[model samples]
Target: MTRFLARRTAMLVATMLVASFAIYGALYVSPGSPLSALTGNRPLPPEAKAQLEARYHLNEPFLVRYWHWLVSALHGDLGESIPLHENVSTLIGQRVGVTAGLVLLTSVIIVIAGVGLGILGALGKGLVDNGVLLASTVSAALPSFAAAVVLQFVVAVKLGWLPALGTGHGFADSLRHLLLPALALAATSVALVTRVTRAAVREETGREHVQTAVSRGLPWPSVVRRHVLRNAAIPITTVVGITIASLIALSAVVETAFGLNGLGAYLVQAAQNKDVAVVQGISLVLVLAFVLTNMLVDIAYAVLDPRLTLGGRAA
Candidate 1:
């Protein structure tokens, strides 16, 4: 277990280094430098531009810029936002909690309801199965933005059950306003988890162990509990981890549609404004989220089956 954890830690560090460096390269490769944009359209004189360049280290080599950004990043400083004229880290921090909450709540809903539906669908190959399959297919086919819009119209506008604008308050109020957006982000994820779980569980039930349990008259439910569901959870856990990672960026449309001021929405805004610092900051956050989610999935493998290793070392 210790060896496994060490390997995973090494892999995680390598992934972060690669992701951050790539983001640094992209930011530099873009045309019309951030410094130029930060300056006004009045066309500052050569001397003035030079002063600005020297002050901001715009004249530094690409390597210098990369190293500077990386060092600052290590200290939790993501630099300043050109458009907002504020610390990018500060701006991102303001929205991180909201986004994290939305992501977590959405994940919970997807696992519990979606996986439950999937298990039910898999247990019987009749109308319930067909219905669940159809629903999953439709949800999967729909683009995330379209799903948000449709939900906005039917649930938010038509029924008026959910608020179109987000509310900041106690947990109850926040959840009430977050319902629509969370549902939109979760719809496709739920479908994927449900479909995958159902198939995995059904397949597990047909295995030799499950058949033997049935032959021993261990009661159908007991057989499912011991031999089928237990094995099925492994795959379902994997899918859920992926779902959580995807959810980090998937909430953008829902955030915009519902006016929930979250990281996804902030990222879109930064992109539109061409605020590279803010955009990269948000991107780094998402990458971190992806990495953490994967680590959690790895840990869960050990939780669900002790036979699994922590870092994929010898069990």
Candidate 2:
């Protein structure tokens, strides 16, 4: 276990490094120089441009800048936000909790709704199963933004059941504001998890072990709980992990739609302003999150099924 964890940690570090480089390179390669965004309509003098470049180390080679940025980032210095003129770390610190809360709540909802529906569908062979499958299919086909808009209109705007914009103050208030956006963000994940779970459990239900349990005169529910769901846990766990990881990216759309000042909203603004520092910082953070989540999922596999070995042949 120790060796496996060490190896996976090394891989995570490498993955994060590669992701950071890709984010930095992609930004540099995109249209419009960072300088252009800074200057806006006003044309800067040659000296002014040179000064700005030197200050931000933009005049240095890409490798040199990236290395410097990486080192600084490792030391918890994410540099300054070009547009906001705030420390990148400080900016993220303020808003990350809100985003984390939103994602956490959404993930809970996904696991409950998706896994519950999937299990119910798997156990029922007729209308219940078909209804769950149909719902999952329709949800899977629906675009996230369209779902967000519809929810925003029907739940927030028309019914006035919840706040349509901005994260409210305090825990209770925040929950009220975050509920709709979290649901919208979780729609696709719920559908994906539901489908994955239902399929996995259904496959397990027909296995010889399940039949043996039934032949032993075990109740259907007992058979399902002890045999079917246990055997299906691996794939279901994988889908749940993927769903949670994707929520970080999806928060961009949901946050924007709801006017939440989270990392996603900050990312969108940074991209629009061509704020390279903020963009790079936030992108790296998200990448690290994604990598960490996957690593946790890998670790979870061994926990979910002890017979399965990590980084070696299964037991």
Instruction: List per-prediction Cα lDDT, in the order shown.
Output: 0.85, 0.88
State candidate 1's TM-score. 0.94
Q: Relative to the unseen true structure, what is the C-alpha lDDT of residue 64 in candidate 1, on a scale of 0 to 100?
A: 89
| TM-score on alpha carbons, each prediction | 0.94, 0.94
Q: Write the per-residue lDDT of candidate 1 for residues 42-153, one digit (tens) a residue.
A: 6788997898778667799989888898899889999888766799889999999889999988998899978898899999778999999999998888777888889889
Candidate 2 clashing pairs? none
RMSD of each: 2.0, 1.9
lDDT of 1: 0.85
Candidate topping lDDT: 2
Error of 2 at 219 (Å): 2.9
lDDT at position 200, candidate 2: 95
53-164 in candidate 2: lDDT tens per residue? 8988889998998899889999998988766778999989998987999999999999999999999898888999999999998878766688889898999889999888
